[model samples]
Target chain A: MGQFFVFIKKEFYHIFRDRWTMIILLILPVIMLTLFGFAITTEVKNTKLGVFDPSKDIATRSIIQRLQANEYFILKKFISNPDRIEDEFQRGEVGLIIVFPEKFYENLLHTGEGQIQLITDGSDPNNAITLTNYATNIVASYQQELNKTAVIPYQIVPEIKLLYNPRLKGAYNFVPGIMGMILMLICAMMTSVAIAREKEKGTMELLLVSPMKPLVVILSKVVPYFFVSIINLATILLLSVYVLEVPVTGSLFWLIIISLIYIFLSLALGILISSLVNSQVVALLISGAVLMMPVLLLSGMIFPVESMPYLLQLLSNAVPARWFIMAIKKLMIKGLDVTSIYKELIILGSMAFFFIVVSLKTFKNRL
Target chain B: MQVIEAENLTKRFGKFTAVDSISFDVKEGEIFGFLGANGAGKTTAMRMLCGLIKPTSGQGIVAGYDIKKQSENVKANIGYMSQRFSIYEDLKVWENLRLFAGIYGIPNRKINDRIDELLKRLGFESEKDTLVKSLPLGWKQKLAFLVAIVHEPKVVFLDEPTGGVDPASRRQFWELIYEATDRGITVFVTTHYMEEAEYCNRVSIMVDGRIEAMDSPRNLKNKFEAESMDEVFHKLARKSTRTGD
Candidate 1:
């Protein structure tokens, strides 16, 4: 136990002594959380909206006011002619354009129906769709208000309520992903590189010749990295909750339990990678290619796994981050119970066991 | 008593034999020089004796423990230093010493005293808090040697420990080895330098994974009718067919 503590202390000294390593270990998580939370957001806020209100009637003006009322849209322009709407899009000033047809209130009041044309830049399909949806919701709410005052008894209003996250905040979606990514970065990448450094420096040879068991040495190397990942987990949780305003809605206890399992799995993967490779560069490359790419692309962190091709969806099952992100989304956002995430718990737990067993078996006790 | 004894010890990777049926013994407190060409299997044999690798066949005993079955016990009684600088460059000098001493199971109470004594002997008391990366390479190598034997092991294995040192540092390193042997610790060292062989009590020359000559440097020179150990080595190593490691 004393030897183990000494080894862990030496490992910590190695981590803290290097300026860049210390920065990457401690500061990288916060940077990534902030970057993913704010910069790479999917939520379309303050979209520049161009309007062509040809009718300029009271009802049209009221609907326009309703559109510009919320934080999601800001009316940027009022085009005089329909032909100029295309020019406004070409100017790249607005992502969406709402063209209220002539006699808009007349057609709506007398004929009991009106046609409003919504023109959007199709170059960015998703943003175009989101902006259109927000505009449609505003118009629908205006129609519903008109129904409340006037005696329109049979009109339909499809009340859309976004569950779990009502405002569709991107932070809620990425908080779990950032947690998975940050934990994997610290546990898998850092631990493998640390072990490979000992090999590259020829210190592993000296270590193996000592009375200390190789298992103890490996555990000692992993303990410091494990702690770093835990600290990162705390940082990510705190940032997401306090800074980004994405609270942990589910049981924090089960959330922590699952995260601990995922951390163990990542650390085991790091040990397994270190066992196969003998140099720091190779270890880093393998972990980056094998761990980072899958976590980013296949884990449904940034991309929805349901929309991916069938083969990629099948391949995503092998990525451990997929299950972790899923579980975190359920716990942190949906605020579900422990029974809701038993599948993720089992998969992550088994992966941790498998990696630990394989790494121990393949660990080179001899050279 | 023999601190290290190997009889017909061999190691094979796939079909290629690295150390082939080598046999030798080193008495306690003796400086045994293991001389070889680059790919001549000196490291493999040394690793087997140090209990870092298992021999493919035959037997090795280090400090009265079998290399194959009791490797852990063998490790407990032996120390190893490589040509590569093995100490942590990022750690402070005293931290490195304390780490190794603690890992070797030296008592926590005694580790500070051991570090102080070692630093005093090396005249490195002032540099105790200095990072090892800032130190000169010669000092790092010397410090590595001291830390390798910090547990006071029965035998110490040095694999080309003076590979890239200056002549003065190399001479000083030999003095350290002499000092270690005086304390009854067996020194099993491998080197490429022939002049260093003259300082060893017994020297063995290896060619193509087999010991070609084993005796004192004087006996090898007398038998080969050569003026120096370098010439004796050349006469024996010229018959080799092996290439790069």
Candidate 2:
């Protein structure tokens, strides 16, 4: 244990004394957190809106007021002529336009039905579709208020509630994915490059000839990365909660425990990679180009797994980040307990065990 | 006391043999030079004896431990230096000393003093805090040798320890090797420079994965009817099927 601590201290020296490594370890997490927090979103906010209310009646004004009061849209200018509505949208000044018909309030009072035109820029189909949904919901709420006392045919009513993320803020999803990605970056990539560096420098031969056991040497190399990964986890968590307003509704202790397990698995993968490759460049490339892309695409960070093709869904199972992200989402977003995530934890545990076994076997074969 | 004894030590990779049935013995407090042209199996034989790899078929004892069965024991009792500078270049001189000392099971209270004594004796006191990478190649090689034998092992194996060093630094490195042998640590070193073979008490020449000649320099010179080890090596190495040097 004393020797192991000494090795760990040297590993830390390697990390701290190098300026490039220190920058990557310290600054990369903040950059990735801010980037993912801001970029990863599909929900529209503060969209530019224009309205051409030709009727200008009480009901049409009331519906427009509801849309403007919400955080989804900022009412730009009112267009007097209908022709100018398209001109404004074409100028990129407005993402959506609300046009109330000439008899909007009269039709609502006498016939109990009205027409409201929702014209939107269709350059981005996704943005257009989401904006349309927002406009439709606002108009529907206004109609419900108008029909509070009116008797009509019996209708089936449905009530909906979102469980984990009530606000559906993108940061809630991104925070967990960031935790998975940053931990992999720090633990797996750093450790593999470190070990491969020793091999490339011929220091691994000196280590092999020493009295230090190979297992102890590998463990010592991983210790500093494991601690650094925890620091990154804390960084992402604090930033998400305090700055981004994404709260951790679950037990903080359980969240840390799961993250620690994930860090260990990543470190094991690093050891396995270092054992297989001899050059630091190869190690860096494999860990970055090979491991990182799968983590990014298949981990359900940017894309949902269920919506993917069936083949891709099966391929996602091979990505350790997929399970880690899933488990973290349940704990941080769903506020679930440890027992609730036994399946994900089991998969991560097995993967860690497999990597460790393969790494040890490779070391033994070399010996 | 023979510190290293090997007979019929062989290593094969698939169908090709890298080290073919080589044999040698070195006594305590001796400088045994391992001389070979490139691809002549000097490194392969040394690696087997150092317990870095298993020999295909051999009977060997290193520091009173079997090379095959008690390879771990052999490892514990031997120090190894490679052609490349093996010390941690990113670490300071004293920190590298502390790391090797700690791993070799040296006591904590003695580590600082040991490092201080090493620096003082080697006339490198001013470089205690300098990073190893900042030092010249010659200094790094010397430090690697010092670190390898930090535990005072029974024997030290050096693989081309002075490959790219200048003549002045090479002279200083040889002095350090002599100092180590005077303290009764067996020295097993491999070198490409035939002139270095003259400094060893006994030298062996390897050609085509086998030892073509093993004897004192003078005897080897007399047997080959050559004046220097370089000429002797040229005569024997000319018979090689691989390289007709």
Report the CAPRI category for model 1. high
**TM-scores of chain A across candidates:** 0.96, 0.92
Instruction: Write out the backbone clash pairs for model 2.
Output: none
Candidate 2 - CAPRI tier?
Answer: high
Clashing pairs in 1: none
Per-residue lDDT tens digits of candidate 1, residues B84-132? Answer: 9699999899998899898888998999988898788788899999999
Superposed Cα deviation of residue A3, candidate 1 (Å): 0.6
Q: Whole-model Cα lDDT per candidate?
A: 0.90, 0.87
Candidate maximizing TM-score: 1
Superposition error at A187 for model 1 (Å): 0.8
Candidate 1 lDDT, A1-367, residue by residue in tens: 9999999999998998889899999999999989989998989999888889889999999988888888998999898888787788888898888988899999888888888888998889988877777777888888888888888632465667679987778899898888888899889999999999999998888888898888999999999998888888888998998999999999999999999999999998999999888999999999999999999999999899999999999999999999999999999999898999999999999999998888888885434
